[model samples]
Target chain A: MKGSGGARRAPRSTPRPRGRPPGRSSRDGVIAGRDALLAAAERAIARDGPRVTLDAIAAEAGVTKPILYRGVGDRDALVFALAERLTRRMTDQVAEQVARTEDPEDMLRRLVRGYLELAAAQRNLYLFVTAGGVGDKRLQQSLLLADGAAQQFVDGIAAFRSARGADPAVATVWSYGLVGSLHYVTLWWLREPSLELETVTEHITSLLWTGLRLEEPVD
Target chain B: MKGSGGARRAPRSTPRPRGRPPGRSSRDGVIAGRDALLAAAERAIARDGPRVTLDAIAAEAGVTKPILYRGVGDRDALVFALAERLTRRMTDQVAEQVARTEDPEDMLRRLVRGYLELAAAQRNLYLFVTAGGVGDKRLQQSLLLADGAAQQFVDGIAAFRSARGADPAVATVWSYGLVGSLHYVTLWWLREPSLELETVTEHITSLLWTGLRLEEPVD
Candidate 1:
């Protein structure tokens, strides 16, 4: 229902039929199959938390583990796919909010607040994709999300700095710092739910907006 | 030799002899055993990278896996112990640097530069202790290091704000933001080794010092 006409025409029950002929329509079917597996994976994570196994995800999809893996590769690949999905959604939401606001301060507050809200809403899935593994794969998955988010900011930041007659090279470092700070703050807030969302947002916005030094510069 | 007299007298090779008499000296023996195991873990991680197994670590310590487990608990516990050890050394270095500098800017630069240098020096161990695992244990372990670093900054930031007649409440959030930013920046730099340490430290310092807005405030 959500995809193109070709996808809609494909049978939902059997997205990829065995011994299917290779064609444009079949390619769409493959896409649909992968999407279905991802959707099932999200559901499984939501239901069973971060420890949800691939078997459980396959069961949720009404398919075998081989089918699930065939559709989405392995567990790490699935996590990367989920991370891509989540970060895309987050990026879209923040971009929408940024588009509506011209004020830099308001833009930052909206960005921070929107990020926290989305992360909190998808708390289980966020944990599932971001913190569910160890080693290089986990670090790569997290960096993928953070780097994607930072990429979205780089252009905007560069433009803003150029307009102000400042070096735009700082955009890369600043964007990474901002995104990383927000990422960790979200993790801390998720763990300590007692902290008010507004408090966290305002504090972050203030720190970024005015810098850490509250006193007037002697120079 | 590093510890008190009781620890010095304890046999380093056979730290905990089986059927040892129960006394204050034996308690010292237990402490020495744990330290020896931790040292072995550091050596193993340094040699084999983050994926170094408990068996490898035990072999490095010249003990069996059971002895290693008894001394350091499990893999997670060993990781935690290593994290604590690394963070303590980092904290001590930062504190020493802070003590030597009166200029706040210099202090911050020293902190950031020192952190990067230390992390680069022990890159394998850093990866081992920080990114070796996934799930709640990984998060908890990372948080332990971040929180410890943030704790060191809380008082300093609070006092700085108080002296300027600003509310000190922002200290907690600011400290976390600063530490988390540094943590991620270190991770990024570690991955992208082309970035110079001085360059990264300067950019972070400038970001924290002057913030994102490079122009004069309209207000």
Candidate 2:
């Protein structure tokens, strides 16, 4: 019972790998094996689209289905792991870009552009992780991604609001809302890629920068 | 095939009721039957929560599983129908409130309040329709809901932006983004029901009204 129920049953079908691959510590070998399987899964999904099956993924990795199960637990767990990987890459890219900019407006623009570009580059993987799955697992994956992004956002938003003498309490709500908006917008863009990246970025930036109203006081 | 593949397979197991129930036209009878079944579904879901099975719904409706299937097609179709029903109600409520308000700010506030209140009132049904389901079907349901709302919002948003000399071209993106933000915020509010309705409404209103920045001029 190394993992979930699916993984628990896997060992009976195929015994666990006996020893670490030459010269690596057992822990490092486990991490390396998992990484290799995930990369193979990514390749299968990228080639075959989101509906790529675990059997296909195992074949892509040159492993048996039971080995794939042992490596990733189940479809839901695999999706979760892939989602985490994608979001981490996107987050790191956005953070690196944000770090390079000091002006608030520039930082915002960089963040938006970074996120959209990364998602666009990894379109199939994005859809695979985010769009296709069972309901509860999909929702869990979404919440996991949003919560991680929101956690990164809340502190910065709170500090910024406080510096502006505004209520910082809205940070949690604002962060979640912002992430949700970005997520939906990205999906829309991916579906209708005819919209230029610059144009889409500009529209979102304008909306966030100026709000919905173009010319009315908020009285 | 009367509907999707699931519905197509349903007819053999439970031959659809052949005659109109007493005195009603065939079409009217079909409508009435569907309405009754849906109403029964609402009750079952309301009582048992979102994961209530088709068998349970059929029992609640005082019908056999086959009859339930014939009436509603399948789980996905039932979920789709329920989402349409809920969104229609919410839309009508919001539209009526918007019609009553001459002030733009007031209209926006009413729209937000109306959506949140209706969703909060129908919490169980809302979860059943939106939160629990298969992945592709769930995404389709969400897009169906969002597209309906976006269609309603786009014309109004375009008109308002045009009046203010803003780019009406951004209307489609803006409408979709707005709906997505409101939807995610509602889900967050529902899961953490401790937050006051008034507070949630206020925060969202401020975000849409003023955007993310508390202070600073766009370059």
After TM-score superposition, what is the CA distance of residue A98 in candidate 2 from its true location, in Å? Answer: 3.0
Candidate 2, B17-104: lDDT as tens digits: 7653665445644543888999999999999877788998998887777788888888889999998888888888789988897776
Q: What is the lDDT of residue A133 in candidate 1?
A: 54
Clashing pairs in 1: A133-B134, A134-B133, A134-B134
Query: What does DockQ give for each predicted structure?
Result: 0.28, 0.31
Candidate 1 chain A weakest lDDT stretch, 10 residues: A1-10
lDDT of 2 at A114: 83
* Clash pairs for candidate 2: none
Candidate 2 stretches with Cα past 4 Å from truth are: A1-32, A64-66, A132-139, A164-168, A217-219, B1-32, B62-74, B132-139, B164-168, B217-219
Q: For residues A124-167, could you state the per-residue lDDT of candidate 2 as single tens digits? A: 88777776554334445665556776556556755665655445
Q: Cα RMSD to native, each candidate?
A: 11.0, 6.6
Identify the runs in model 1 with alpha carbons over 4 angstroms from their true place: A1-32, A163-169, A217-219, B1-32, B163-169, B216-219
lDDT (tens digit, per residue) of candidate 1 on B89-167 = 9999878887798777788888888888999999889887777655556656767666787666656755665655444
Tell me the lDDT of model 2 at B69. Answer: 84
Kindly report the docking quality category of candidate 2.
Answer: acceptable
Least well predicted 10-residue stretch by lDDT in candidate 1 chain B: B1-10
